[model samples]
Target: MTTLMTVLGIAVFAVGLLISIAWHELGHLSTAKLFGIRVPQYMVGFGPTVFSRKKGDTEYGVKAIPMGGYIRMIGMFPPGDDGRITARASSPFRSMIEDARSAAFEELQPGDEERLFYTRKPWKRVIVMFAGPFMNLVLAVLLFLGVLMGFGIRAQTTTVGSVSDCVISQSAASAGKTACGKGDPASPAKKAGLRAGDRITGFDGRPVTDWDTLQNDIRRTTGPATITVDRRGGDVTLNADLIRNQVAKSDGHGGYVDGQYVSAGFLGFTPAAGIVKQGFGDSVGQMGSMVHATVGSLVNLPERIPALWRSAFDGAPRQPDSPMGVVGAARVGGEVFSLDIPPEQRIATMLMLVAGFNLSLFLFNMLPLLPLDGGHIAGALWEAVKRNLARVFRRPDPGPFDVAKMMPVAYVVAGIFLSFTVLVLIADVVNPVKIT
Candidate 1:
């Protein structure tokens, strides 16, 4: 029964993934059709078709892989000189091809010849290219709004839920002592004079509303010295010295694992953080704050990427509880589905996650590479500006150039995507992102 339920949960997540991919592709398809561009094939997934159907002019199908979807526009690639599109358009054995490329331009039935995508206005073409990311953005915003208006939001309070079993060593603990030796605090925590039971209310004037805020802020601390606490509701301030936390965790083997740690100047004080409910009108505020937090994370990616890469490539294996991936997401989803959370809260949580997923999709897709919505948007903008500039100088309007001309960019995009996939797979195998 447990196995079956787990399988079912994965299926649900796969469905959601399909919906996200389809919604992104649908944005392009609908907008293209609105402008009368020909869409020869519309497909979900990649690789050979497991299922398919032929519509009026388009062949609709599902591919073997469940990662994403695409709509193949006629003459989309290779300045038309690549000859693949033209040859395919001219191929005699088109129908012999599998469904993955089966409905491509060359394979379209005779009646479907009139609506080639290139015939559309440049503006429409541009819109078609951008619609996917646009849809992703819309999805994200609604997700935020839904959680806010429907179930309300929660804000973090300074009160600790429970201190973690793992103390941040060197965090105001006594030197040469593993456990705050003689109460003479070791390094950073001791130098800063931080103590337990002190509630940190501010850091460098940034209000520490809750544990989440505090931790996230701490990661952002660079070349900093200062700590403020609201000990028993009384304000206490001290200069914080930078210190590192090196935790020696168990390898689960007979031997201990050497844990190289990351940290800032800790005042030795720690508190468990949690989400407490916010008021009705404040749900909107909750959305805004959460977004702010996420955006901050994104901005910090350049630095964080190094840590992630080191963790991945280092000789030591990564711990499973480190971060998240599909496995973790599925676990969370399954737990929610089985939870006793009130309907509103449950729904809100689910929406928030989905929204985050969609938002991440949007950000990732906008990376300005081929095969992604961002890549096309980037290409279209380049072409539009170049052509329009030439036109203003009285040069004859050039005919549509083949996007296939951008083949190099396309390959680079493919490589990046492949790397990301590999990273995710590695993370899944090692960390598993389990909710529990």
Candidate 2:
């Protein structure tokens, strides 16, 4: 049964992956058509076509490989400086440029002269290229908001789960030294008679509904305070002398890291965690944190390649923060499904994973490098800048920047990306990250 569930999870994730790819291509196709650009083929994969249907002027199809997709827009590049498509070249780099130009004009119909992508205004071209990544971004935000506001997330509540027996510093407690020392004193919560399952209602005469606020208030107050609790259908009040102690505070990224401590009033009670719906503001804030973390991860990717290589070949354990390819993500989805968790929780987690994937897609594609949407946008913006500068100086308008000239650079970038992808794939298979 567990194996079946894992397979089912993988199948579901595969479907979602295909849908995301299709959706991404649809953004390009729709925007290109809207701008009167002739997109000859709208493909959802890179390899040979498995299924296709020619409708109107475009051939829509699904390919065998499900990794990525594209829309072949006519005349992606403007003509050469001579105002005509350049002929074949002898040099390898020149051949790459000519090949790109040929592909851009291969399906150019007679009337496509006006419908070419490069003929459109710079702003329109920007929109056409930006639409794909923007779609992924929108999907990510919607999914994140849906999960956060609708299904809620697992978080600590005001109800007490455990009370510490003795006052221990945060660093000491983290090091598996929880036992009371000879000179240690009882924790404030324990000394105040707080017990498990007691739902904290008020702190220091102020009503508290959530754990964060209650925790902050407790940390700030250093003197005696009234603690109101709802226990056994009765309101109970107790006086507790708060003590100044070292505690681990939030690092603002949903985690508490070492060396980030503060001197605060310690309650020494662990809050019970449960699924709690978040407000729109809180959801947005969480999304911002996720974006920040994702960007940091991408920035640190080069520094992590050595570790990844070691894990792939040296039998080293996979780091939790290690980068994952599609295979790793699908394996994680399978693990999430096979976990001994409630169905709703599993579904929510799976959705969150997909949402994070989409967010990463958006961020990854937005890098201003060739073969990506952001690269084209950058080209168009550069062209606009050049033309505007020419106009300011009372000079001839430098026509659309010949983005085709950057074919060599684009090839190098693509090769590096492919190499990195293969490395991640090998690492993912060899040292797959465990859910635990």
Candidate 3:
């Protein structure tokens, strides 16, 4: 039964992945055609085509490998200064440029002379290139909002789940000394007569509704403090002196890190969990935080390669924040389905995973580096800047930016990306990150 569920989860993720790829390519195809650029093919995958059909001027198809997708636009790069696709050259770098230039015009038809992508206005070209990643961002936002506002997310509530018998320092806890020793002091919650099932309504004199704010308030207060709770249809106030003690550090997301310790006022009680639906503002805020975190991850990606190598080849444990590929994500999806949780929660988690992946795709593709969509956008923008500056200086209008010249750099970037992807794949297979 577990195996079947795992297979089902993987199948579901595969479908979602295909949809995301097709959706991303559709953005490029639609925008290119709208801008009068001739797009010859819109493919949802790489390698040999499994199925394809010509529609109007474009051939739409799916390939065997569901890894990535692309749309082939005619004349993506302008011809050389001599007004023709230059012949193959002696140097490998020069050959790369010529090959790219030739491929861009390979589908040149009679009417395509004026319909080339490079012939479009720089702004239009920017839109054509930016559309793909923007679509992913839009999809990610919608998915996240659906899961957050529609399905609701599991959150901590004001109700107490359990009260500690004695206060245990985080250092002691991290050392595996969870049980209270004879010298341990009675916990504030236990001493103040706070019990499980007590729904705390206020801390000090301020009204407490959410666990995050309440936890922060608890950490900030020391000495005598007042806690009001709704106990059996009656409001009860308990008084206790909050003490400074070592505790687990906050993850900044209403959660505590297990092994990381910090000195703060200790609460010695666990908050109960409940499903909470977020409003539009809250949902948007959550997405903003997620985007910020994703950007940080991308910025730190280069530093993670060494860790990935160790995990893949040196038998090192995979770090929780290690880079994950499609394989790792799919494995996580399988585990999500197999977990002993409500069906809705499991589905919500899976959707969140897909949403996060889409978000990552948007940010990754937006990098201003060659071979990625953002590279073309950056090139177009640079061309626009150069032309505007020339106009201001009363200089001759420069021709379209020769993107073909950067083909060598694009190839180098592509090679690096491919190598990193393979390393991530190996790490994912040999030492996968498991959420249990």
Best by TM-score, which number? 2
Ranking 1 against 3 by lDDT, winner: 3
Off by over 4 Å in 2: none
TM-score of 3: 0.91
Candidate 1, residues 1-436, lDDT tens digits: the string is: 5565456556666777777778888898899778766777789999989998988767788899887789877644322433344334434333222221322455445554456665565676678888987887788877677666656555445553433222345423334544423444355545566665667778877777655567656555655566678777689887765544543332322123444344443434445434455445455565565566566665665555444554556534444434345555666666555565565675676677677777777777777777677776776677677789888998976666555545555666688657756665666555454444
Q: Model 1: how far is 285 from its true place, Å?
A: 4.8
Please, what's the RMSD in Å of model 3?
Answer: 2.6
Candidate 3 Cα errors over 4 Å, as ranges: 167-185, 204-206, 220-226, 232-252, 256-267
Which clashing pairs does model 3 show?
A: none
- Score candidate 1 by TM-score against the native: 0.62
For residue 120, model 2's alpha carbon misses the true position, in angstroms, by 0.6
Over 50-98, each residue of candidate 2 has an lDDT whose tens digit, in order, gives 9999999999999998899999998999888777786668999988888
Better of 1 and 2 by TM-score: 2
Q: Relative to the true structure, how large is the alpha-carbon lDDT of every model?
A: 0.62, 0.90, 0.91
